[model samples]
Target chain A: MSELELQNKKAAAFVSTETIDGEIATLNLGPTHPATHGIFQNILQVDGERILSAEQTVGYIHRAFEKLAERRPYNQIAPITDRLNYCSSPINNMGWHMTVEKLIGAEMPKRVDYMRVIVMELARIADHLVCNSVIGVDTGALTGFTYMFQEREKIYDIYEEICGARLTTNVGRIGGFDRDFNKEFITKLRAFLKEFPKKFDEFGALLERNRIFMDRTIGAGPISAERALSYSFAGPNLRAAGVDYDVRVMKPYSSYQDFDFNIPVGNDGDTYDRFMVRQQEIRESLKIIHQALENMPQGDYHADIPSFYLPPKEEVYSSMEALIYHFKIVMGETPIPQGEVYHSVEGGNGELGYYLVSDGGRTPYRLHFRRPCFIYYQAYPEMITGSLLSDAILTMSSMNVIAGELDA
Target chain B: MSEFATKIKDSILEKYNNTSYELDTYGEHNFICSKNDIHAVVEFLKNEGFIFLTDLTGSHYPESEGAEFQVVYHIHNLAENVRFRLKVDLAQNDLHVPTLTDLFAGANWMERETFDFFGIIFEGHPNLTRILNVDDMDYHPMKKEYALEDETRTDKDDTFFGR
Candidate 1:
C-alpha cells in the first residue's frame, strides 16, 4: 500500500475522520478513566509515543454555573459558587459574596474582613497541599500523598469546627460570616498552625531530594514566561513562569493589603518549577494566615446590616422585624440593585473572579466565573508536546487541574 | 502603578485616532477598557509590551435590550507587573469577533468557553466546538434561554453523568 492509502486507512479508524501527519501515531487518552481526573477527553497526535499535538475535549463536568446564578438571588448563589471549585468551596464562597457586596456597596467590619482573609488563605493552603501531594502520588511517591492527606484531614477538621461542613462550606454570608469564630475554633487553628510547619517541612524533605521525583518533574511541561502569560495562566502556574502577579497583592480584596507576604516565583517554568512555587506559596499562605489571625480585629464578625446578614437566633425569635427581614432575605424578597461588577480574588488555582450583573430584581441578570483551571488547562498540550505519556500525567497533576474548576 | 497600564488610556486614545477609552484603575496598573475597537486596541497593547492575555470570559445580561454578551479579558505585562481588563460587547445577531489566539496561544480554551456560554463566534478560532456541552445539544447551556426545570435535574443531566 502507498503512504496515502495507509494514511486513509488510519483516518477511517477514528470516529471523526480527521488526520494530521508529522511522523506521529494517533492516541486517545480518555473520555472515561480515573487518571484523566474527570470526564475530560484528549485526542493526541503522537510521534513514537511523543505527543505532537493534544486536543482536549472538556464539558464532561460543566454545570452551567453562569446560567444557574442568573435565576438565583445574590445570597442564594453562594451554594452554586461552592460547586464551581468544589475542592476550595470557602474561597468560592468568599469570592461570590465579596463580588455581590462590592456590587451593592457593602462594607464589612474590619474583623469580618480579617476573618475572611484567614479563611481564604487557609483554603488556599488546603488546596495547594492537595495539589502538591497528588502530583507526588502521580510521580510514584505515594508516601508524600499519605503524609499530606493527614495534614489536610486536620485542616478539614478545623473547617468543620468553624463552619459545620468540611468540603461544601457555605461559610460566608453576604455581609460577613454566618457566625462568630469561637475560642474552640481559635484553639484548633493555633494547634494546627503549630504542627503544620513541621509537617510541611517533612513532606518537602521527603520529595525535594528524591532523585526519581526530581527527574520526573524537573524539565517536564516547561513553558516560557511569555507563553505562560499569553495562556492566561493564574496562581502557581503563572507564578511558576516567573511573574509576581497575585490578585491579593495587585487588588487587595478582603483586606489582603493588611498582611505582608511575598509572592514566590520560579525561574524555569516547568513541572518542578510549579511544584516549588506551590510549595513556597503554601508557606506564604501559612504566614498570611498567622498574621491575619494574630492581628484579627476586635469587632462583630457579621456586618451590621440586618437585611443582608442573617440575624442572631435570639433576635430572630424576639423581634418581629428580625423575623420579617430573615424571611425576606431567605425568600429573595429583597430588591437587588441594577449594576454589574467583576470581582477577582486569588484562589488556590489562580484568579477566581465573579462577574455579576443585577437588574433591580431578586435574581441576578448575569453571573460569569473567570475560572483558573479553564485557562491553565489550555496549556496542557503545549506543556506535554514533546514529553512522555507519564510526563503528561505528572504535568497535569502538578498543574492541579481540578475537574470541578475546569468544567465549571 | 505599572508603567504599561499608567499610559494605556492615553496610548489607546492616541492609537485609535482619538477614540475615548474608559480606563478605570482598580489597583496599581489594573485598567478596564470598553469593548469598542477592542481587537485593534489589544493588538496595539500586545505590541507595546502588555503581552500577557491572562483571562477571557463572557457574561450575559438578559434584561439588557440588544447588547447581551459582554466578553472580558484580563491581561498582564510580565516586565512591568501590570494587569488590566479589556471588555467587548457583542449583540445576539453580531456575535462574532476576530480570534486573539494568533497573539496569545493560551486563549484556546477561554475563547471556547466564551463560545460555549454566550455563543460569541471567534472568526479565526481553530476549533470552536462545544467544549462544555453535549456535541448534539443545540442551545448554549450558559445562556438564560436554557433554564432547568428543577434543581435535581442539574445533578443527573448536565455534568459528566448526563445522558
Candidate 2:
C-alpha cells in the first residue's frame, strides 16, 4: 500500500477502536466531495446516520498569502487579497487598500467613500445570494440556487462595468478607485437595483417557509450565543446569535457611518437563523446601496495622494511630472512609515481585519488577514458534534466557509 | 483614551507594577508583557469584559534582540466597543507561552496556526498540531530565516528564466 493509504488505514483502525459502541463507522466527507462546498476534509465518526464526532482537516488550498505578502510591495498586495474569499473580492480589495490608507493617514474624499460603499454593498449581495441559495441546495432545493445565480450574474455584470473582471476582481487602489464609474456602469447598477429585489423575494418564497427546508435547518446545527462568542463569531454568524456587534457599526470605515441602516439579529444561532439573518442583510445592503447612490457626491473619485495614487495613463504618456510619478509608484519607491495598524471592515462573511506592520520598507514587514471563515470554522466540529450527518452538510453550507479564506 | 480603555490599563499597571510591563497607545492600546505573565494578563482582561478574542497570531523579528518571536492578541469588549492588543515576546531558546484554550475555545486553532507557522509552542494546548500546513512539513515557514519560495523548484532557475 502507498504511504497515504497505510496512514488512512491506521487512522481508521484507531478511530474504530476508540468507539465505545459496537458497529460504529468512520467516513471521510471530503477534500473533493460535492457536499463540501470547497476542498475541506472532515473525518466524521458515525453511528449509522448520526455523527458522533467530527475532526476537520483544512489547508488543501493553503496559498501562504501572509508569507507571499512579505515579498511583494504594498500596492501589489491588493491582487493577492482578491483571492481570499473570492466571492466578495471587492471587499477584500477595499479592506487591504483601506488598511494601507490607514497606515499613511490619507483622508479620502466623500465621493470616493460613497462610491466604495456602493461597490462593497453590491459585493455583499453577491456573497449572500451564493451563501443563502447554496444553503437551499444543501437542503435539497436546487431551484433557488439556479434562480439566484442569475441575479449573481447581474451583480457580476456591474462588477465588470466597474473593474473589467467578473469573479476574482482586483478592483480599486490604495487611495481610491483606478477610474470613475462611467455612465454605463451607473445605468447597469440602476437596472440591477430595480430588478434584484423581486428576484430575491421570489427566491426567499421558495425556501423561507417551506416545511422541508424549515425542518432541515431550524435546529440542526444550533449553537448557543455564549459559545458563539467564545469562538469569536462575527458578521452574519454572530449577528444570527443575537449579538449586535458589527465591525461597520463598532468601527466604521470608508464613510459607513454616514449610511443609515439597521443591524439585523436573530434569536437562535442555527442554519435557519443564519439563512434568515443573511436574507435580512441583503435587504439592508440594498438599502445602503440606494442611500449611497442617492447621496453620491460630485468630486474627485480617487484621493489626491500623489505619492501613493498613480497618475492618469494619458498624463503619464505626455507630462514629465506625471511620468516620473508613475514610474516612482510602479517601482514601489514611496516611503512607508515604520508603525503598525489594524483596520477591519464589515466583510461579506464577517469582520475582515488587516493587521499590517511596516518597517519603512517597500514590502510589509508582516501582514495578517483576520479571516472570519477561519475563525468560525473552528466552531464547526463543536456545533455539529451531536447532529446528524446530513445536518452537518447543511451547517457547513450555512457557515459559508470559503476554502480560500479558511486556508489563507 | 476612553474611560473603558483607561480603567483596564490602570488595573493591569497597578496589578503588575508599571515597570514590569511596557504600555503604549500607538495603534490600539498595546501592553507588552513577559511570556510568563501572559496567561494571568489574559485572565485579568477576560474578567475586565474583554470577552472576545478577535485574533491571536505570531510575528517573527530576527533583528530584535532578546525578542525573536512576538505573539500578539487582539481582544475586544463587545458591550463597551473597546479593543486592545496584548503582546508576549519570546526568545529563540524559550519559544513557549501558556495556551489560552482554557479561557477561549477558539484559541485552539489560532494557537495551532501560530505553532504551525512560527513554531511558538503554546504550552497546555490539547492538540497542538499543524492546522494549515501538511503534517510532515519540517520547518516553520513564517520565520524570517525561511525563504518564501521553494528552493527545490528547478523550472524557474535563474539560468533558464534569464533573470
Candidate 3:
C-alpha cells in the first residue's frame, strides 16, 4: 500500500465501519480506579489501546467547601482550606490567611515573613515528592517511589514539629505562626536540609536518565506553551511548558522577593518535562529555604495584632483583657474591613490562589480557591486524545489532579 | 488609579464605549462591562496582554438591584506581571453572558462551575452542565437564599425553646 493509502486505511479503522476489528470501546478510567488515586471518572472512547476521546465526570468528592466557607469566620476557614490541596495544605492555609490579612491590612513582621517562606517551601517539596514519585510508580519504577516517600515523611515530620499535624497541616495563622519555630523544629529542619539532597538525588539518578522511564514519558501527552497558557495552567505544569510564570517571581507574596532562586523551565509540556521541572523546582525550593533560614529575622514570629492573635490559655484565665481578647479571637469578631482581596502562592503542581470577599460580617461573604489541579485537568482530554492507555494514566499522575481540589 | 491603570482603562474604553471601572474592595482595578459586551471586552483585554485567565468565579447578591448575579474574571499579563479583574453583572431575570471558551479554552470548566454554583447561564457554552454539583440538583447552592442550616433537623426547635 502507498503512504496515503495506509493513512486513509488507519483513519477508516477509527470511524464506525461496522467491523469487529474497527469497534470503538468505552473505558471508564475511574470514579475510584486504583490508578486515579482519587474519586473522579473519565469515560474514555478507545480504539483498542489508543484513546480517541475522554469525557470526565468530577464532583464525586465535592464537599461544598466554598458554601461552607461562607458561614465560617476567617480563622476557622484555614482547616477547610487545608483540604483543597491536601498534598500541600500549609500553602493553602497560608494563602487563605494572607488573603484575609490583605483585607484587614495586617503588616507581617520580617521574621514572620521568613518563617512563612520556610514552611511554604517545605510544603512545596512535600507536594512535589508525591507527584513525581507517583509518576515513577506509574512508569513501573516503584523503588524510586518507595524511597521518595521516606523523604516525604521527613517533610511530614518537620510539619509535625511545627504545626502538630501531618498531611492537612493548617500550619500558620493570619499574620504569622501561632508560636515561634521551636528548637526541635529548627534542628529537624537543619538535619532534613542536610540529608534530603542525597536521597533526592539518588531517586533522580534512578529514573532521570533511565531509558525505560524516558521511553514511557518523553513524548507522551505533550502540550505546547500557547495551549498551556490558554488553558490557564499554573505552577510546575505551566513552567514545564516553558512560560517561566512562577507566582513567587511574577507577584512575590509572603516576602518571597527577599529570597533568590531560579524558575526552572521545560520546553515540551509532557510527562517527562513535567517530572523534570518538578525535580529542578525541588532544588530551587531548597535554595529559597536556605536563603530564608540564613536571613531569618530576630523578632516575633507573628505580628503584633492583639485581636487577631489568640491569647494563651493561662493569660485568658487570669487577665480580664486577655479574656475578652480570647473571646473575640475564638469568635472571630475582629473588625474586618469590608473588602475583596486575592492572593496566590506557588503550590506543588501550580498556583494556588485565594479570592476573598468580606461584608463586615463574622463570616466571609464569598471565597474562591483558584485550584491549579482543577484548571490543569481541563486540558486532560486534549492531551490524551491519541495516547496509549498507559500514557493516559501517566499523564493523569503527572498532572496531579487531586480530587479534593478538583471538586472543591 | 495609577497611570498604567488609566492607560488600560482608556484603551478598553476607546474601543468599547459602554464600559466603566473602579478600584475594587482590595484597591485593585476592576473593569465592569455589560453582559452583552463581556466577550468583546475580554477579547480586548486579551489583546492588551491580559491573556492568562487565572480565575473565573461567580458571586450572588440577591439584594443588589441590577447585579444579583456577578461573574468575576481574574486575568494576568505574564510579560508585564500585571493583573486585571473584569466583572460582568446580570439582572435576576436575564442571567446570561456570552461564554469565554472561544477566547480562553480554560473558561469551559470555569463557566460550568460558575453556572453550577450560582446558576448564571453562560450563553453559547458547548456543554453547560453542572460541574461541581450533582446533575439533578434543583437549586444553585451558593446563592444567599439557600440557608446553610439543614431545615430537616428535629432538635432545637425555636418554637419549643421560646414562644
Candidate 4:
C-alpha cells in the first residue's frame, strides 16, 4: 500500500476509462478471449464491470461464402457448406446436397438414406457434447468438460475413420457418401455407443445438482415461446423454449418420419432448459443411430445417373461411355433440369436449409442458406438483458452460437 | 391439417384468387400464394394465429425474362402444431417487398441477409444495415450475377476487385 503503487493503480484505472455518447463507462470483451467461444467482439456499455448494454460486433470471420457459392457449380457448393457449421459439417453438407437433390428430383437409395441418418445423428451427439461441456466450463466446472470432450473425441475418431479428415469433413458426394462404410467404422461407433452413455451420465451427475452451475443457468436467459418463435430461433434453442416444434417431426425431411424418437421440450425456456434439451437429444440421437444401423437397406449408395456422378475408374478405363460420363461430371457440364427447391433439415443447431435455383446450368443461378444460428444470435441481446456479463457466456454456450454458421 | 393453416389458406384463396395472385397448393397445409397477395396473405396468417415466421428465403432463375426470383416464407402455428409456406415472385429489376418485422421480430435479420445476398430491399425495415457484409462493401453477393472474378476478390476492404 505505498503511495506510488496506489497512484499507479489509479492511473491504470483512469487510462481504461472512456466515454461513449457522453456516458463514461465502456469495456471491450474479446476479439480474442477464451470465454467468447469464437472470434467475436462485444462492446459493453458498463457501470463498474456490470454490463448495462452489450453491443455485439461480429463478421471478423465472414468469408463471403454465399458470394463464393454463386460462382461455383451447385455440386461444388458442398465444400462451402463444410465451412458454415464447421463443428457439424456433415449436417450442413447433407442439407445443401438435399436441396440440390430436391431440385433435380434425384432419389437416393434407402441404404444411403439410413447411412445419412446415422452420420447426422452422430454429428448431433458431438455438437451437443460441446454445448453441454462448454456450459460446464463457463459455470466453473472444468472436470465435467474433460469428461465430455473425451466422448466427443471418440465421436471425432469415428468421423475420421468414416472420412479421412476429422473436423471439416466433406464426406458426402452430391448424391451419397463418396465411399461406403466398412465393418471397422461400425465397430468403433458401437464402442462409442457403449462408452458415451457412461460418460454422459457421469457428466450429468456432476453438474445437474451442482449448486453454482444451476444458479448461473436456471433462470439466466428466460425467453417465452412467443419471443423465441418471433426471433426465428430453431433447433434446441427453440425447443428448449417449450415450442415442441422439431422440424424433423413437423416437416419430416430425409425420411426422418420413419424414425421414432421423442422431441424433448423444456417448460421454463431458460439457459438451463437449452442445456437440458441438448443433453436429452444426445440420447435420442443414439437411439436414431441404433435404429438406422439395424434397419439399413441394401442397395446402391449413389444414384444411377452416371452423367451427374462419376463412374468407377475400372469402368472409365474399360468403356468409352464411362469415360465420357466421367469427363462430363468432372467438368460439371451435366445438365440439370431447370427448377427450384427449398430443402430443410433439422440441424443440431436449428433448421439448416438451402434454397437452390437452377437454370439447367452447371452452376447455381442463386443459392440462399437459411442459417439458424444467424437468426438465433441476432436475438442474443434480448436473451441477455438484465443478466450479468458472465451470463452472456453461459447464454451463448447454451444457445450454441457457432460463429461460422451465424456469420454465413 | 390444423384449422389455423387451412382457414388462412382458404380465406386468402377465397378473397384474392384473381389475375394478380395465383394460388397453388404445394401440400395439404402448404399453399404457394402469388407475390401480389403476399402482404395481405401474411397479414391474415399472422392475425389467424399462424404467427411464427420460421424462415424467409429466395431462389433465382437467370433465364426467365422478367420473373426470376421466387421467395418463400415458411410459417408455423405453435397453438395448432401446423406449418405452411407463403411465396412471392419478383422480377429481376424490382426485387423489393414490404418488411415483415412489423409482423415478426425475427424477420429483421432474415430480411437483412436476404438483402445482402439477393440485393432485395425491405421497404420499411427499421435497421437495414448489412449483418454479414461490411458497411463499405457494395455488391449484393448472393445475386446470380455476382461471380468470383479472381483470387484478389476474397479481400473485403480491397473493394476494387472486379472494377
Counted clashes in each candidate structure? 6, 0, 1, 0
* Candidate 2 lDDT by residue in tens digits, A310-351: 998999999998998898788787888888988899999999
Pairs of residues clashing in candidate 4: none
The clash number for model 4 is 0
Report the lDDT tens digits of candidate 1 across residue range A1-408: 532244345534532332333355678888876676666788887665565567788888777777766667778889888887777899999998888788777889999989988888788888989888888878878898898898888888888877899998998799998778888889989999999899899999988777888988899989888778777788888889887788888778888888889999998889898999999988989999989888988998887887787787889899999999988887777866676677888888998877666778778876778888887887787678656788888888788888888887
Off by over 4 Å in 1: A1-24, B1-7, B14-36, B59-69, B74-85, B150-163
lDDT score of residue A61 within candidate 3: 86
Give every collision pair in model 3. A235-A350
Local lDDT at A153 for model 3: 92
DockQ of 4: 0.38
Off by over 4 Å in 2: A1-22, B18-27, B150-163
When sorted by lDDT, best at the front, the candidate numbers are 2, 3, 1, 4
User: In terms of lDDT, which candidate is strongest?
Assistant: 2
CA lDDT, candidate 1, residue A326:
84
DockQ for candidate 2? 0.50
True contacts kept of each: 0.75, 0.73, 0.79, 0.69
TM-score (C-alpha, index-matched) for candidate 1? 0.88
**Model 1 clash pairs?**
A24-A46, A24-A47, A59-B132, A231-B106, A232-B54, B35-B88
In model 4, which runs have C-alpha deviations exceeding 4 angstroms?
A1-24, B1-7, B17-37, B58-72, B77-96, B150-163
Candidate 3 per-residue C-alpha lDDT over A208-315 given as tens digits, one digit per residue, 9 for 90 to 100: 999989988998889999999999999888888889898898778888888888988999999999999999989989999999998888999888888888877899
Error of 2 at A62 (Å): 0.4
Between candidates 2 and 4, the one scoring higher on DockQ is 2
